[model samples]
Target: MLGQKNPPVDRGQATAIIVFILGLGALLPWNFFVTASLYFKERLAVNVAVNMTLNMVVNGTHAGHTKDYNFDSWMAFLSMLPLLLFTLLNSFLYQWVRERVRVAFSMVAILLLFSLTAALVRVQMEPDTFFSITMATIWFINTFSAVLQGSLFGMVGLLPSRYSTLFMSGQGLAGIFAAVAMLISVLSNADGINAALGYFITPCVAMVAILACYTLLPHLEFARFYLNRDETDKQPIEKMPIKSRDKTVLKNSEDPKDPEAPVLQDYKLPEKHTHNQPRLSVFAVFKKIWVMAACITCIFGVTLAVFPVITVKVQTSYRGYTRWDKVFTCVCCFIMFNSMDLVGRSVPSLVQWPRKESRLFPVVVVSRVLFIPLLMMCNIPDSKLGTIFSHDFAFVVIMALFAFSNGYFASLCMAYAPQLVRSRDCETAGALMTFFLALGLSLGASISFLFGYLV
Candidate 1:
């Protein structure tokens, strides 16, 4: 039976855990930025005058300023540039090397950089250091993480659909974990230094754990099974040993001590089948999944354009909710979105609707652009015009829907992409898909800046 050569189904649970962890680690850098959002608003000066004053009298524009400068949208936009550029570069290089190599390299770089950055932040407690220095560190960490995520998701695409689903769910989990931590910090009335330390401690611990997982992954029986499948697919028939009447002679040839291999009786090399199943070119894979890629790009782009920047800025006009406003706007929204997103991603494991080959996926994705207007109409600050969906409840509901759709559509696109091409080119299809994801994030981040001004 063909079942003899198939991977054991029992290994699914272990593989799922590994893929989930991989997804978690890949998105941790971004999570670090989001979770530490409060620190940025507090420590980094946005106003030129405040920066000058801090620089001359205190540590140059590095200390916490009294005046708050709305830098979220601009920070989102600026942050994506390096990530977008490096994702493309990594995607291009994927055509030449294995995804594991790139993933490993990026992971090591991430660990070292984060360790170094955390140490610098700890030692240089003076608020006077250049904000540019901090921004530079953030940018580089994001850039490397972009490459790491592209490679990791691409690798996941080569596996079963459930792996990619779990991977996405893990990303949502990171957001949930972060949101909960921030909420706890707020409730406990932690000082600024203690709060910042919380953010630093979480990643340092997570990164170390992730590094151990990566090291052990290759040795896991579950991981090895999929890797073996990949190797089998790439090896030609001619390279395999031919059946022989003199099994002893063939066995002798395989022995490392036998410098001169013995000729086996009634053995002949297998014929190569090059005419069938040629590898798909990168562009060909792109064309096959361009619509899917577009859906991913648009989904992320629309999300990046609004979230935390525009959506997080909107709060109730009530006076009593002032103390909890930041918590409600930033932390609660993130938790709601992340929870809904986890549900959305998990749904595909049970039901893969609107098949990847169907035209409906892209249509559904494009329709999401409508959320842009809907979100903008919420109770935003300084708006003279009244909105029908002005209430906080309505905003939370919309955010839930927005996040759910994002997870569902993104998971579908990624899981479906590799299926469109030959097994050998699945990774390429994945890398191409990751490229579009970055493109979407970049587009959305850029659009966020404009929306910030408008809001």
Candidate 2:
């Protein structure tokens, strides 16, 4: 990590560099899953009631199966284990693979797992139950994809901090493209089984192809230009004796307005501090900021929980909405959410929010409290708000707000993680974040099933 420091790069150069590093299509696959989920629900009408019922039964069989048993609660309870395990595994493996290899492997892994799960559920379930299992399977794939994306973010952050700005720009562009793709897919004459496969398969394959090409592109290492303080300060300083008044007078008289005066001014630089220490270890880093990590993890759980449910809500409440409308709504919401998220990522650089040690806890607590009301609003009776807003529009607005909150929280969490941990520990911290994300998603899906049954 030791290197000579160069002058800071301009914003244009930084953005270009991040795009070059993260690749243009890095996020395409991530967005593909989002689009595919919407496409299936709208086009195929894949109901998940059977899968939820099965999971509930599985949970109940393990218990006494008493008359007092609550199946919804049981499903939520049983889902925690896989979610936790997947998260832990994701965190541990995030650092194990090389960056380029990790991207390829993760894409293939998700595609394969998703395809297998979808095919299996399609074959096994009756027509009524197919959608439900398919959705559940999508949840599993989503958790996997999230872990991979978090690792990518962590690795990009490791690039000299200057490159962070570039990462955001690239993310923004990718999000825009994803939104456009979703819109196109919805407008096209795609529906039923063929449409579902087309929406899901085509983009994923395209993304894999694009990413493979990226692997062959040469990597640019900009870190070489920057000089460390130790390297710069090692130059010896020469001792200069004070001149007597006569000598100073004679020199000044002879060299008044000398051309070298500007050189002398440049030479009078401030003393540089030298501390050639290794980056902190993972444990040391976590010890300093575990609370923030825990809070972010919980928020991630909540966000993941809410997203899939939005699709469900639309399907349930606005049955009359055209397939295109449903797909368009989901895609537009995703784009809007990601676009806002990209903005939030850049906010810390533009403005200063409260940054005191004690302030963080309160800020996070307030954010969590805000989330509760927003979530409750989503569940409010459509009849009550029918006068003010259509159920569909209200759902979309609530989801957009949810996305906005998620983006803000995610940006803050990324910013805080590095400050709390050591440079080397970034990968580990990232993995832990992903673990929490997966745990949250699994729990969220289980919760959705339980709630669906209860309602």
Candidate 3:
């Protein structure tokens, strides 16, 4: 009977659920990418410098006495673009495609394109041409990575309500595993700095492997489960009114000045039900999403804008600290912030004073405002406590608070999104959220670059 309200249990939903779980497993390897980049920063710099010089020579420009470009810094910034682009593209595709086979094919095609591009650059570039080649390679790899990441996440969004448990459990497990790996990395090494730095690649590789495994799962299952197969197999569900007294009233009420309304009015009804029609225009859905995306982007932008400066402040202001101490501080900060985020997301009712959707807007605005003051505090010259706290503790506290606020705000936003549209439009809503997330990151990074120049 419930299947009458919502579509039946299907293989597509089952597959999506499985994929979502595997995607969570992928998180375990996140550290690998981070650590790999950090471990090879010096080498990357040397390669980039050599490549830049060679390119300058080949292009008939002066190669002598070039100011060193920090490859690590540039790579960090450049890497984000691929992910952002993929996310934006994925959002569009998720709405357009109906079949899981089509979705998977599109995903693979994009990934292959990125991989091939990277491979071409890698094979063609000489050691002296490393900087440009490395940047190109990183972009290609990132594009492929982003596709993988986006597809996995997108699959989760496609899961049927009944199988949502599988996705959530997978994500929860992934978080736990990530925390455990970090803990192990921290404890195993005599010098926590090396451990922390060295362990980044593990998480990224794990993510890739897990995602790859998930990629091979049954695509048809997801299509059948997530989508209304009967509707999809036919000409789509008809937007017919429910056989209820309320529907009759709704139909009659459409003609505001109708004489027949008097006859229907005399027959009082105790209860009524109306069938809600869904919007079919993809453009209209996308436009609605754009507004929410813009808001989220602005919020995220304000938060991320200061990240680069924060790291610099930590290094310079807390100069006297040991390497291990610095690592410890960073790890502690990450833990605190993520912990708060987890708590807020998991137990939103505990923190939300007034649990309403509108509350999110104010929360986001206030969080952004808080960042400005917190950032300014870092620049205080005389107050050792302020400086020390800013360097070691302030970021953690600010990020934690930001995370908490964002969690509550996101949950509220998600809850409110469906009400703004029809039931079928939830996927589009998710896509919009991701679109804004990418936009926010890109904007924040760019703004950070500008701020770096000014400061």
Pick the lDDT winner: 1
Candidate 1: regions farther than 4 A off: 1-4, 46-74, 125-129, 234-278, 321-326
Q: What would the TM-score be for candidate 2 when compared with the true structure?
A: 0.60
Off by over 4 Å in 3: 1-35, 46-67, 94-129, 145-155, 158-209, 212-279, 315-324, 348-366, 379-395, 411-419, 453-455
Put down candidate 2 lDDT per residue, 1-455, tens digits, no spaces.
22322223333354345343353354554555555545444433233444445667887633222232232233234344544675576555654666556666666776675466435522544544554555455555555555556666566544443344445445555665666766776667755555555555655565565555445332332332221222433432111112322242233332436532211211112223322345455556567667656666666666645444433443324556677456744454566666665665556455434452566653663465454335444533442322333355565666666665555555555555544544445566655655555555565655555444332
lDDT of candidate 3 over 1-455, digit per residue (tens): 11122223343344645554564652322223333343345444555577677788789766565456576567766667876887667656655665354445534543443344334422434444555655665665556545444444444444432222243334435554554555565446446334543354444455445546555564453344344523432322222123433454445443546433222221123212212344346568766655455666776576567653443344324556676564553464445544554455444323433433454565545456566446545544443335534454565666667656554454444334333444356555555555566677678777776655444
Model 3: residue 218 alpha-carbon error in angstroms: 6.0
- Model 2: lDDT to the true structure: 0.49
For residue 113, what is the lDDT in candidate 1?
Answer: 69
Which residue pairs collide in model 2, if any? Answer: 4-226, 4-227, 5-226, 5-227, 6-226, 46-131, 47-131, 47-132, 48-132
Cα TM-score per model: 0.82, 0.60, 0.62
Report the C-alpha displacement of residue 336, candidate 2, in angstroms: 4.3
User: For model 1, where is the 10-residue window of minimal lDDT?
Assistant: 1-10
Local lDDT at 235 for model 2: 34
Candidate 1 at residue 238, lDDT? Answer: 17
Cα lDDT, all candidates: 0.71, 0.49, 0.49
